[model samples]
Target: MAEVNFCLGPHVGLRPAVPGIKRAPDPPESYSALELQVAEPPVQQLEVISGVESVQLPCRTTAELHDVVKVEWTDSGDRKVHVHSCVPEEPEDQNQVYRDRTEMREDPLRTGDLSLTLRFPTVRDNRTYTCSVYSRAGRPRVETRVELQVRAQQVEVDSGAESVQLPFETTADLPEDTLVVWWCDEPEPAKKVHEHGTESDQHEVYRGRTRMREDPLNTGIFTLTLNRPTVRDAGTYACRVYGAGLIFLREKTFQLTVKGVSVLLLCAPTAAAVSLNVSPNLQQFFSDDSVSLSCVVGAQAGGQAVKRTAGGQTDLCGSGFGTFDGSSCTVSGLSPSDSGVYWCEAACEQMSQQVNISVCPRNDFARCPFILEIPALPVTAGSEVTLRCRNKDGSTHAVYFFRNGVHIRDTTMQRVKVEEFSVSEVQQSDEGLYWCSTDLLGPSHRSWLSVRAPPAPPPPPSVSLVRLICLLVVVCLFCICTVLMVLMCCSRKTGNKSPVAMEMTQCFGEYDDIAAGISTEHDF
Candidate 1:
């Protein structure tokens, strides 16, 4: 138990003094109870142009304390101020308006920082605010005046027309007398379309199409609708508030165009008849001897038809075939010129279809005549001769040469060599009626040869001498007959005398010419 002390210092009544136990010494001032002091009051910054949702305040203090601290706030303004703290729990004592928004914590004391946040802040709610801090040793308080400002909502639209619709999310608290205006660069005169109040502000073009929530003043919603949108109905539109000196603006645009379909052509084998079909006009077929072409068409009412060059579309008749209709097309009469891929196009309602066609030619070398010719004949034996073998059809594919009904060789001879068969020299052995023939393509031709031996040499002169001697003997005999005739004539006269007489006459004449020096060897 500690001692008790009673003492009365001179003032009102009689005094009594009883001090038996010594009192504890008073603590030094440094360790005594303390009270915090702020150098300046907290102040919320203000701006003429401001946002509707938030406000900032600048505040500072001069208090120096080393202990846990607690902060308290009170909204002194007439309007509601929703207070919020970055800390975890709500403060001990707070205004009813901040009952749901207030927060507090111990972390701020450790960091030596303090701040308060107000939610759903507004211009009308701006006012003075007071903050008090309770420390282990003392209590400190700060007061600040905050000015609030409201910034106008901004809207923008992109369009060529004079006016457009205005759209908004929350329209609550919006005044009924709010003004909305439409703006754009006027070609002739620069002016703006101004309307007052949400009710009377009707744009002629957007009149029936405009609408708002039942309680526009409370919901703060303004919506404009367009029933039949047109290109001329597009431009920038905005809402303005005259009292608050604020302007809220929004912008829009529209575009217009026409629609349409297509036409196509089709063709096939270039040398043959081509087929085509169309809804609008009949297809045309054209050809030279080398190529045949077919045109396909579609109705002009729905679309346009055009000719597409080669390689423009896929061929319906395989890779080389060409198509012309929206479905298919073809071209025929295939020549060298027509031997390419073709395309046909059908355009309708801004859409088109393409088709491809291909063409090819038939081979004509298979039908030439097979007849061959053998130019000249009557070749001499053993003399070199050439046989010309030619096809009447002029086809060299089947030209073959034959000798004596047997194929000897092919006729690949040069100019004159093709004319005849040659033999080095004329001999009796080569005396046959020789000929050459060729099965060029169709028929064959044959030629003949005529060979004869030369005449024999003249006979010897000895045989002629022999024949002359014989002729001499016959002359002698004839002479003897003549002598006999004469002798007989004489003998007829002298025969009567005797035959010896005639002989003696002949012998005597011969001996007499001989004795006379006439060479008798010539007569004898």
Candidate 2:
């Protein structure tokens, strides 16, 4: 053991001056008797804006400390935020508010980056958080505290009445002496509409019209009531709550919109008759093409139609569609979202007419526009021909067929199918223009057909002279052979040998010889 002696002066009982006290030099001990304690690192403060997509809570360790096997995060209210362990491989237990919103590094033990990511951060997440690490032997090692400050959220409110009350509340428990101020539009320079403790310079417009209910400590309600709110009072209003020593606790902003009689007066109408019609009246469209719709406005029916006319709305066309003139709209490279009821309205009598436009994908032919199919032109007059009307999507409605722009007939099928009109033994009258229409939004295109009569074939060919002569020779030979046979039989019965019979028999014998030779040649 080693003993030390202090060289203190007589003034040691009082506060010692510099160089008044000294210690002995040599000590034979291997180590000092007093142990020095190492203090933990200071807490980190992180500020975040409300409604952020994500936030990262940092907690890092060094490379030499490889035994960091577990990380735990807990809120200031004693609620578990997240827990990651390498022990039993069981599921972690997290708070309901932070269940699906928290994530850490995939290989945290190796990387030493045990950072928590909170997604879709809200205002209620502002508080103190603790992150503690443990070794594989279940020994607590390092810890860190984080202070999270989230900025206030902004809200929008629209009112149609003359008077309105804007309500505000906070989750933080503030003290009784906290200062609360209501500011309009800009709260940085403090556009003080109303304040709790002190009198401030307020704008002349809101000096006597705005009031606040200062029950922040008891009921937590700091509602603002504005009397006779006009269009000029429509803007952002912020409620700033301050703690002791003028420290800002939290802020809440409200966007107000006041709609009164003055707004209605700007939208008043005039007295006149108006009518509208759409050109190139496309009942439906496809996504691959562009659409151009022109609204033709007239003072009366079929009287002096004009384009570029403004209607009740400031812009005549709606969203996803643009206007060159006030009355014409063009939608380029249309999409399925462009399908809706499009209307043109005039200021007089609120006159408006709607045209439904349906946009479909290029691959979806069933929802495409109507089409008309016609047979080949110049068809035979006695042939059966058919005309068909087809829509991309099948319909069960009655299909009407027209000829020369006049209704001819309608066909209704059991199951809604493509419409067809067939003409049996078609006449020349059926040669006119033809088209078919179903329940589609518009008429189908027309096609022309021409009917023609079939021509008569040529008469049969006349016989040649050589063939006529051959037929006569065959008849004479047959007669001669029959007579010879009769005469030979009669000569045998009556023993009568006539000259004419003998001559005919000689001729028949000669003819028989010629016939035999001819038959032999034909056989070869």
Candidate 3:
């Protein structure tokens, strides 16, 4: 079965089976200590996938709102989504498209939950919806805005996985004459991945590899399973549902990625002070493609020399590495040995930051019509990353980008060369199986982007408290020993002394005798 996820908070790591837009919680009631005054309402965004059945746009207030207040939800375009009041309900006031699809709780004003429930939401429903609470006297009281995004369904899988499920389900019973069709864009024309009725028209490559639920008509779970998927199987897949007389009901798009050898990369601090730029700035390239490398020095001096380190050897731009005019290095007919880190060195031994260029072993461009450009190494998080849907002949075509089986970006304006899609401030969620395509140029091979956290700094030197205590004990013992030795020496010197001159000891009477005894003991 196709997995469904609803995330209205912080998201990290892998993308869900289907990804939704970002959302934030409602702002707290700002008029808490005020005397029944309204607070400036802040806008919050909520994300939900259209195929995920339903979603909630939350709006709540702690203030004592009036019981007879009216609650209404409308889009930024002034389209009404829902309305409720103390008067008779007018369902006709809502937009025709949202007439039966929106819902609100009974006496929503009394409970202070003015949230709106949008069902079976699709791309057409993506908009900023405002929730307003009006006083009984037609004065504004509390207003909360919610921006809801309804994204397409997506699914991703490893190339060697046993099976992958593409989800499509609904609560409303489909018409008895409903027809389901599944197709993927691959091999020049669209590949017929599966159909509900018959297997005779199935493609040879997908004959025994596709299946669906048996009681799809009754259960409404029409998820498709592709068995033993391969790398070439990565592309955009669509599931179309039809009603009686072949009337189109709905269509869901899936960006499927059969990941091959994945690249996990992390960047390091710049070795030098120069910046390296690659023309057409692709992360990965096939062997024998021409590339222009420029080492830009912030100082911008005219006579500075540029250098590169690749294939285990450092080559000065003026040498066989490429034609170099001090600042730029242009290499034609790149090879596997040319895949290495490139950087610039200054006259005073300062090194600039290095850039890595990865060259895949297989030249799928030599066989296929196009190949996606990606880094062979893991990308450092928060850096800009560019993905190019490069044609074999470098002709410009309408290029599309898909991450983990979901369409993300497309360059349709061919007025200029728009085959490249650059992702700025790359995040971990942006990491996935990415492939590109064009109307004339065939689909590019899938490239898995891996965003890695920066390497942690080395810990400071540790001092041991136990060792410190031991040193203190040793110092005290040494001081005590020195004091005792001095005392003992003084006592021994007095003990070894002759009391006094025997003649003087006589002390010429009784006074002399007491003085002699005291002098022997006290050693004065």
Candidate 4:
């Protein structure tokens, strides 16, 4: 058994520190009845700036050990910061405050790198963290401690305010020669907002705009005051304190944002360069058609993020039938199920205006009476078309109509049983997005009206010029033959009329009449 001896006098009640152990160490390895020495674990100091994404509490070992059980990390308040078990089947029992924000190495036992990273670290995480390693026998085998100090804050204000205050205070008693400076990252190079030391070079813009409550930041109350705040002053401002010889003591970072002019595109109308447009951009489309929607973010330098919410399910642009590229998403072979609301998110944390896309079901509205009855097919020009606006229930209010999002007509001045109305001999110009509504049902779903061109009239048929000439030639030959035969008989016997010319004109007229009949029959 090892005999534990305490140092006499002042060190009697102190911790486990090796006897005669100083800056140099060549202590005996094994402890028996003879005198022995055991080294004390050192505490590492970590100075982290707040407002950063995260900070790491490092604990590592190079010595070889065996039968590892678990590694636990706890804060000064005895709250569990992180825990990793060697056994793979156990569930994590982390606190709710640090549930999804803590992460550790996968295999701490093998690699001996038991480091805990705290995400979105704030001033609340500033404390001492103890890392303890246990063996398979449920005994602590190794221990180490770390002290973390987080520095920063966040401030938000509205534009046109008289003055804004970046508050910073410390309970630690600072030196008289301490220098405090508030730096802003909003400008090109880092600019000093307020300096409380000897005269130094200051930016021209903030010369008369900044001041401090104290003359020299004597007791570490280094708060800054800026006059006439504007949208250009929105950025990170850090208050850094320095002691004698310019030694850094503490720091607090502030994310200062002035609203009104510096707001996101989601709600503001000042973003004139950005545009969102849709192809075949009508309010509705027939089923089986393809829809292409695109957004141009011009100078806004954020990655593209487009989302569609349809049928109570939200999906990104790259899933299902939608395909995404730089700033656009395309969905082809659309159906009624593809109808939804879509919007895009810019990298500046700004969101574009939402768009509603409707993939019409080609007149399959047998289920609900809450839609405007549109023509299933295109109506011909100069043809009467009937539109029936369905309602959840009937009403006596006059039906009002809208075409292409504009009020164009109305009907039913008296009490009408039917909630629908019709239009007669609709011109081609009347075809557009149409909707009907009454005082009770509000308005029905919008539908598009299409007009087709009217058919041309038939022309009268005429006889062919070549056929008429042929008929005349054949008639002349027949008449000449008959006349020659008659003249021969007259010479042989007695006859008095002009036999050749007698029936010539009459033969021509008769043939012309017959030709007209033949042509007419062929045409029919």
Better of 2 and 4 by TM-score: 4
lDDT of 1 by residue, 186-250 (tens): 22122233333342423222333334445545565544433223333333333333323443222
Question: Candidate 4 at residue 137, lDDT?
Answer: 47
Question: Estimated TM-score per prediction?
Answer: 0.24, 0.27, 0.37, 0.28
What order do candidates take by lDDT, descending? 3, 4, 2, 1
Model 3, span 130-208: residue lDDT tens: 8876643454566778878776666778643556898877644666688888887543356677988776445434555
lDDT of each: 0.37, 0.58, 0.65, 0.64
**Candidate 2 residue pairs that clash:** 366-392, 366-393
Candidate 3, position 168, lDDT: 79
How does candidate 4 score on lDDT? Answer: 0.64
- Model 1: weakest 10-residue lDDT segment is 256-265
lDDT (Cα, tens digit) per residue for candidate 4, span 303-350:
667766665356788775588886678888778787765656554544
Please name the candidate that would achieve the greatest lDDT relative to the true structure.
3
lDDT of 4 at 406: 61
Best by TM-score: 3
Error of model 1, residue 114, in angstroms: 1.8
